[model samples]
Target: MQASGYSFKELLGFDIAVLSELFSSYTTLDATRHNELMLYFEGVNKAWNHPGFTFLYHYQQYVELDAEPYSYTRFFEHYRRKYPKEKGSMKLQHIAGEEMFVDFAGKKLQIVDKHTGEVIAVEVFVAILPCSQYTYIQACRSQKREDMISCCTAALRFYGGSPKGIVSDNLKSAVNRSSRYEADINRSFKDFARHYNCVINPTRSYAPQLFNIKTIYNI
Candidate 1:
């Protein structure tokens, strides 16, 4: 009904073509298109292409498809919304004597030589038990391979028992190569873990959120 007491069609100057949209039902895009987009996204994420690969480059492949491909903005939005840097946060269970997290503090400690009046800066290595929150700190000359291994070994000895695993960051001294899926441990560090009957599990290479020891132990 029209407010002027006349039929809406009589009052309006437009035809049914313009008003047809109001009564029309909007339809969803084809599911096949979304599935195909996800396929391309997964392939790119799996390192199928060069490190510098971009969405725009891959989107070109589907230019010939019948349906229009998603815009760059929409494509990126879906990728980021679906796939995160790391899987969403999960509850990690830390059994007693299960794992030890090790890292070097950013702040360095200094030692003074009385005779020469010289000061030496030392790296502070820290190890924490996830379950007990017990921490072991040691002063080391550097983050070199030998120093890291020595400090780790001493920390284990101090605990009086070796945990099932030792979690660490991708330090050159400890990790030969770091990746999101898998990380290779340095030969010496691998040997050290073997000797102590423990495993060396380095966190994701570039993702520091997974490597934060204090956050892991809630310290």
Candidate 2:
């Protein structure tokens, strides 16, 4: 075969550019679908144990989009290459000014009354901003509904602004009933969210939907 006129380096560069362009083209993939895929990955990772919990399964829900969906294998490959850490536990993305995570610290602190020699053990409220990992902590009398709400409000003030929403574990002070689909948030907590123009999102420690999904996958 006759030798090509172009240098090996030049040919390689052209090939890369063509592949990148084709990969991002509207028919193969578009900005909308790309964004949706990232969000989907994030959601599924957090609730991976959720029902029908697979990328292919979730892709089925986006069939109406104009762009053709990538093949299941390709989809998984692309996401894994882009977000390897997501496959591991204890990895999460926090958007600054978007969300605040609240919980009571496992430890307690002592408060000494100035007037008397009595000491009080107080619960510690902890709120974290996912993006910056900045924390706001306060000592509260207890994890009662009122105290929880007060601490949340104070955390917002300390942070200098309010987030779009707040996330908490299913605690009675924050959640009335924990459900897989939607946990019932406490009325007082709901009011606090309204007052700050934010939302309350509660997560259960044990997921029920995970069980259903595993059963379906097994069958």
Candidate 3:
């Protein structure tokens, strides 16, 4: 086979540095979709202060002027191969109606009282069924047991069915005491789960991977 005389930069139209920057941006932005990362690259190229620091410009030129198709999917596949460490672990298969994951969003939502004109930061409760990826979100005043139960009830009502188990974070409202082996579920939360014919499975303390619905689905 005859080897092409073109240099690597000539073949790819962009140098390795640009590719490295793109990868850095992908990780920093935490982009879940390939097109979203590509869009960010395009935006950076357009708004870059330094004309020499171009990103995706040559790729777009090749696609538009040279009749080559741009494939973000293929680029991402190659990127994953090149950066194996960035790949996530294998996802566990979930059974339908088996489990629902619930947690409060890390960031609080704000609401302004109409009468008092006071801004109140509220907790955002989220629930997701792993198999179907169905989600329920509600804003509550706090993560108190009553509020948590209320949110869970609303989530169940929204789904119109309860799962076999509810996976919850080790918050005080859900778990009375967190442990590595077996956490203690709060009395009210336990009763709520029992009423729904489901079990409350509290995730171990400091182990967010056990309740990783958000990480899996980018919720």
* Candidate 2 residue-wise lDDT, 1-219, digit = tens: 015465656656676676566345456557786777777667656756554355656556655452667677777776777668534444566676998888876557799999997999998787878787677778999999989888987998899999998888888898889987889887888888998899988776584211122222321
User: What TM-score would candidate 2 get against the native?
Assistant: 0.53
**Highest TM-score against the true fold, candidate:** 3
Q: Candidate order by lDDT, highest to lowest?
A: 1, 3, 2
Q: List runs of model 2 lying over 4 Å from the truth.
A: 1-90, 207-219
Q: Model 1 — which ten-residue stretch has the worst lDDT?
A: 210-219
For candidate 2, give the lDDT.
0.72
Q: Write the per-residue lDDT of candidate 1 for residues 59-123, one digit (tens) a residue.
A: 56555552768876787788887786665577778899989998887557799989999999998
Best by lDDT: 1
**In model 1, which runs have C-alpha deviations exceeding 4 angstroms?**
1-91, 210-219
| lDDT of model number 1 | 0.78
* lDDT values for all models: 0.78, 0.72, 0.73
Q: For model 2, what is the error of residue 101's alpha carbon versus the real structure, in angstroms, after optimal superposition?
A: 0.5
Q: Which RMSD values do the candidates have, in order?
A: 14.7, 16.8, 12.4
- Pairs that collide in candidate 3 are none
* Model 3 Cα lDDT, one tens digit per residue, 117-183: 9999999898988888888889999999899999999999999999999998888898878999999
Ranking by TM-score: 3, 1, 2
